[model samples]
Target: MTNTALTGVIPPVCTPLTPSYEVDTGSLTRLVDHLVAGGVDALFLLGSTSEVAFLPDRHRKVVLDTVVGHVAGQVPVLAGVIDMTTPRVLDHVDTAVAAGVDAIVATAPFYARTHPAEIRAHFRAIAARAGRPLYAYDLPVSVHTKLGTDLVLDLAAEGVLAGVKDSSGDDGGLRAVILGRRERADIADFSVLTGSELTVDSALWMGASGVVPGLGNVDPHGYVRLVRAARAGDWAAARAEQERLFHLFELVTVGGTRMGGSSSALGAFKAALHLRGVIDHPTTAPPQIPLDEDETARVGKYLAAGGLI
Candidate 1:
C-alpha cells in the first residue's frame, strides 16, 4: 500500500547475548550474514523476537547498527520501532534511518489501546513525518491493541499506510483487510503477510506476498521449502510440512513453559538457535524467567525429539 516495497520471509531476529547478558555484537553480525546468505528476503532487527522492549536504548542502537553494517545492501533491513510514544517512535525512525535501515515495523502503543480514529491519526502522523515506509505490525497478543481493517483501509486511502503484517492469529481478521482492498482500489497494492507458520501456505494461496514467521528464526531452510511449495501450489507437500511446523509451534507456545501466565516461546526459540550455534547464548531479558537447568534440559529434549534442534 502507498507505493511501499516489502515482502517475503522477514524473521524478527533474536538479540543474541553473552552469558553475562551483554549484547553479543559479533554473534549478531554472524547471524545476519548467515540469514542473508541463507536466502531470506529481508531482515527485521529489534523486533519482539529481538526482545527490543526490555533491551536498553544503547543496546538497541548497537543491534541496529550491527545489522545495517553487516547487511551492506545485501538485502533490505527493517528496524523495529518499539517506542510506545509518538514522539519517541518518530525519533526512532530518524535514528534508524541514520543507521541505514530501509524501512520500519511498528505496532500500536502498548497499554494505550488507541481507537480506530486515534490509530489512523497516529500512523498518519508517523508516515507523514517518516522518511521510509512503515509496516503496520498488528500483534494484539503482545500489545493488546489490534489494527482494525477500517483503520488500515483508511490509512491506505490517505496514502500514509504501508502494508500490514497481520499476526493477529485470526484468518478472518487477515482476510478482512484483503477483501477490503477489493472495495477500494487505493489499497490494491496493500500487501498482507501472515504471521503464523501454519497458515503460511494458505495465506499465500489466498494472495499474501510472503510471511514473517517466528519459526524461520530457527529453521529458515524449512520455511523456505514451505514457501516454495506453497508458491508452486503443491498442496500435497505443503500440507504435510505445515503439519510438522504446527507441532513445533504448539510445542514452543504451550509445552515446557512458565515463569508467568504466558508460555516461553521466545526462550525456547532462542535455546534452539543457540543449540544450532546461530546465537551464542539464549539469554532472555530480565523479568522474563529463563528456563532453569531442568527446564532447559526439558526444552532441549523436546526440540531434539521434534528434530527442531
Candidate 2:
C-alpha cells in the first residue's frame, strides 16, 4: 500500500503506438524518460488520453509491462483499470499489480445505467479486492455518472478510497471534496487531484492536492513549473505559467471541425511528441481520425508560440 499522498503534476500519459497499432515500447520508454526528466511527480498510464477504452486486452498489458519496466520505480506509476464492470476491472487490476504498478485508477461503471449506491458498491468491491491503493476517477463525460461529493467523502471516511481524480470540470464539486477532507478528522490523507489542465492553477488555489493534466504529455516542463509556483505561493508565476499552457491548449481545437474532442486532443499530443522526436509516430488508436497536414501544422504553430518547439 502507498503511504505517501499523490501530490504534484502527474500526467495521464499518451500511449505511443506503431503503424500497426502495436505498443511501441521503444518510443514509450523515451516518452517516460522525457516526463521524468521534466520533473513530473508521477506517471499515469492507460487513462483516457491513453485510449484505454479502445485498446485491446493484450495491448493494455503490453503497455503496462513496458511502462513499468521503463520507469523502474523512479516515480510512482498509476495504471488505469478501465472497464464497464467490476469483474473486468478486477482482471485489469490483477494484471497491473502483476506488472508492478504502485496504484490503480478506476471510473464508475460505463455503458450500463448504475445508481449511486451501485457506484459506491463498485468502488468498495475494488478496494476490498485490490492489493494496492485505489483512486476514484470521476469522469461523467465518459461514464455518464457523476461521482457526487457526498459519495466520495463517504468512501474516503470509510477507507474505501485513497484519493479522487476530479475530471468533471465542476469547481464547486472539487472544492467540496477538498473542504470535506479538511473538515473531517476520520479521513486522513485523502488526496484530491484535478484533471482539468486548463484550470490547474485555480484548482491548486482551491486546495487540490495535485493535477493530472493530459497536456503535460506535450509540455511537461510547463506543468512542472506551474506546480512549483503554486506550491511556493507564487500565484503570479503560477497564473502566468497556466495562462501560457491555456494558450498551448488551443491546439486541441485545431481539428475540432472534423473530429471529436478526444481525437483532436490526443492527436495533437501525439503530433507534438512526434515533432519533438520524443516518439516515433503520432498515430492514435483506431476509429479516431489522425490529424491531417494542416491540422498538424497548427499544432506546430502552437508549440512554437509556447516556446516548446
Candidate 3:
C-alpha cells in the first residue's frame, strides 16, 4: 500500500436527502460532522450504503463534492466509483479525482457477465489513470462476481491495488487476502479492510487492517471503541462490544416482510440517525420503502439497547 492507504473505522456514510428527494445539504453536512466527532478515521462516500446504485449522476456528484468540501482535510475521504463497466466507472473516477478524494474504490464488472481476465483488465485500466490509491470492493451480493484472492494478490503485487474491502461474506477468502498480503515483503503495507460489521472482532483478530461497516453510520463511536479495545488486545471487551453491535444490527430486520433487505437495512440506519437527531429525515432515495412510524420505533428499540439513544 502507498502512504495514502486508508485505515481504521472508515464508515460508509449515508446520503441524507430531503423529502423531495434532493440532496439535503444541511443534513448531509451534519451527518459528516457526526461521523467526524464519532472518532472515525475516514469517510467513504457513494458506496452501497449511500444508495449509489439508485442515485442519479448529478446527485452522486453533489454528494461527493459536498462531503469532501465539508470534511476539508479533517479525514481522508474515499469515493466509490462503482458502475456497470470500466468506461462508466472511469467517468466517476475522473469526477472523484477532480473532487479531491483520497482514494477510489471499484468492484469487478457486473450486469454483463465479465470473465476473470476482464475483471483484471477493468481494475488495471482504472489503476493506470486513477491518480490515486485504488481499493477493490469485493461485494458478490450486489455485483454477482467475486474477486478471487489470486486476482487480488496479482493486482496488489503489480501495484494496481492498494487495498481491498472484503464484503464477500467468505471468511476464508478474507483471510487468504490478508495472508497473501503478509506473505510478500514487497506488499507488506497492503491493507485488508472488512465490511462485515457483525464479525468485526473476529476480522480484527485475524489481522484485518480496519473495517468499513455500513452500521457505522448509526453508531460510529461504538466501532471506534471496538477497534481500540482490539488494538489493546482486550479480546473480551472487543467481543462484548461486538455482541452489543450484533444486537443493534437486528434493526435491519425491522422492515420484516414489508420490504426488501436493502430497504430494511438502509431504512433502519437512516431511521436510527433521525431518532438520534443526526439527520432531518429517515428518507431513503426512492423505491426502497421508507420505514413508517412503527418500523422506525422498532429501530429506536435497538438503538436504545445499544446505548446510542
Model 1, 17-68: lDDT tens per residue?
A: 8877778998888777767766788888887778888888788889888888
**Which is the better candidate, 1 or 2, if ranked by lDDT?**
2
Task: Please give the RMSD to the true structure for each candidate, in Å.
Answer: 2.3, 0.9, 1.1
lDDT of 2 by residue, 1-309 (tens): 463559999999899999999989999999999999999999999999999988999999999999999888899999999999999998998999899999989999989899989999999988887777889999999989999999999998998999999999889999999999999998888999999999999999999989999999999999999999999999999999999999999999987779988899999999999999999999999899999999999999999999988
TM-score of each: 0.92, 0.98, 0.98
Off by over 4 Å in 2: 1-3
* TM-score (C-alpha) between model 1 and the true structure: 0.92
> Sorted on TM-score, highest at the top, how do the candidates line up?
2, 3, 1
Q: What are the lDDT scores of the predictions, listed in order?
A: 0.77, 0.92, 0.92
Deviation of model 2 at 99, angstroms: 0.6
Cand. 1 Cα-lDDT: 0.77
Clashing pairs in 1: none
Please give, for residues 153-202, the per-residue lDDT of candidate 3 as tens digits: 99988889989999999999999998888887767568899999999999
- The pairs that clash in candidate 3 are none
